[model samples]
Target: MPCDLEMGLDNNEDGNGSPETKKIGGVEEEDGDESVGLSRKMSEASICAAEDDEDEEGRKIELGPQCTLKEQLEKDKDDESLRRWKEQLLGSVDIAAVGETLEPEVKILSLAIRTPGRPDIVLQVPESGNPKGLWFTLKEGSRYSLIFTFQVSNNIVAGLKYANTVWKTGVKVDSSKEMLGTFSPQEEPYTHEMPEDTTPSGIFARGSYSARTKFVDDDDKCYLEINYTFDIRKDWQSS
Candidate 1:
């Protein structure tokens, strides 16, 4: 059975001239046994049983009333996704449940960028905002960090197949990949740094820049893919 997968590009800019940050928050999983190693697929009966148990345990928590309108809207979208996933899983056991999960295996809550000797800066990537694209300015020859904060719903072993940034001209800027080890139902935050010496200066760089990431589960299947774009310029702030 083919894996269930969903892919989308999220890019939003902060009208206030702040750096833009894109957030993809949701659980993604394939049909498999988490305890018996990667290739062993879970039986339909077992999955249905698990679903029943979860349903009996009550629904997942909902967003609080204090959330902003945008937050509420995002929550609504997630809820709709969850509902669709449940329907798909319950409707057919023969089909491999790709994006459908009894519970979210992993969800990316937020992404941020940080510079050396400076506090982490939250990019303003709204659900629906400006379309001029997200912008970020970095000091030439300075190291920068890309941070990803996520939530894991179950214990699972996962790794990044690849995480890289590239220019519109097709030149690769920076990239990294490694096993993430075992994670349980908790928040896991990771930081990847771009070396000051290795990174190209935005002043001389032309065209837009984007970061692409692919995440795989223990089964070595790509469950989630994320792409975000932004412009890098010497005088972007003045424009």
Candidate 2:
């Protein structure tokens, strides 16, 4: 039987904005009247300094707008909110289940890469006798497509429910998530393109980059995830 390959690319933007700011680290800011008074005081101090002699330390201190303190407080709140959101998003996996040894119901049959105007390139893993590792060089500023195929075992009705791809190099690049409909015995091949127009453009660092794929069952109860690490470079080398 021919193996089924599934691929999908989602660039849809969803609302994951920062949470509302009401308090920070269990402490609320002063009331509106007090805050306004403090701001006015700061403004008055700045004006007074402008007309007075320089500081005794022999250097003049420049004060920004009166709202600087407020802006900084809001920024701190935003950073904390983002940190909590990331923790919740990536820490949903069960720790106890990590020790279980269970074969995946759905297996990755193959992973292939293709660049626009270029031939398709199939990657080989250790199981296929390529022990060194499966890797390919991706040129900067060029769009590449990835195709994923999966083999569904008997009695398994898994499907590609949610899919996302992220690029991490010290920090995360913008990514998209999609909710694909369920599939029965077998799922179709999925394809996705990287560096979509909306994606930020720049020279990606030349090193290992991780590509993660996840497949969930019809009920969204069980899932299988696979990660592929490959290299990207400015130019391809002949072996």
Candidate 3:
């Protein structure tokens, strides 16, 4: 089957974490496998599966009561080692920044199309559906990747991941997810870049595709969800 096969991931050594789970091209394989990768194909066969009824709405699936950043720090102050570990997890976060809340809030600020040597096409993220209609147009058979800038607040977001399912003309094409390891709340936003990949080319590949993407934590708390559309064409759309 045609696919948007990823080459490899960046070293992501920014003290946050790196992507560990990559479900590429409508297939769920272990991370680092060579057969497939990120930027899964928008085809007509396999779409991402919802694990359970509750999982249908990933964000609403509760993992029970959780502690806030303030609560975590104040609870184990007497234990020196535990306190140090908490400090390490929080990194250099400002106490004034993270609010006193139960769940970590993640805001995906922007999504950019990164093509070699060209100016980035960045689309600012909204709460849900896109008001502008199409997100971007990628040149068929071009080598490009995607990057996301998001901020976390209140507490740590464990096992953060990116997952999206693609569709073309009501046919499910691909379903996949990538795991970006644990991240703590911080003042500056965190940036994650998917490995380079090439877009599929051919008469069939050039068309509009609709997709739904989610930024979710291990607890099934979805911070940001985007529902949008885009196109793959013989050439990039003119500005």
Query: Which sections of candidate 3 miss by over 4 Å?
Result: 1-65, 74-82, 96-99
Better candidate by TM-score, 1 or 2:
1
Candidate 3, residue 137: the lDDT equals 81
Q: Which scores greater on TM-score, model 2 or model 3?
A: 3
lDDT of each: 0.37, 0.38, 0.61
In the range 8-80, model 3's lDDT, one tens digit per residue, is: 2222223433324433211244454432211111111112324331444465344435666676677747877
Top of the candidates by TM-score: 3
Model 1 over residues 5-73: C-alpha lDDT tens digits? 001121111233222221112223542413222212222222122212223447532211232212222
* lDDT comparison, 1 vs 3, better candidate: 3
Q: Write the per-residue lDDT of candidate 2 for residues 1-239, one digit (tens) a residue.
A: 00111112234423432122212112232334232221121222221222232466766544332332223234335466544432332233332332132222455566666666777677643343232443565655455555556544322232234344545563444333333322212234333233322112245355555555555532333355555555555665455
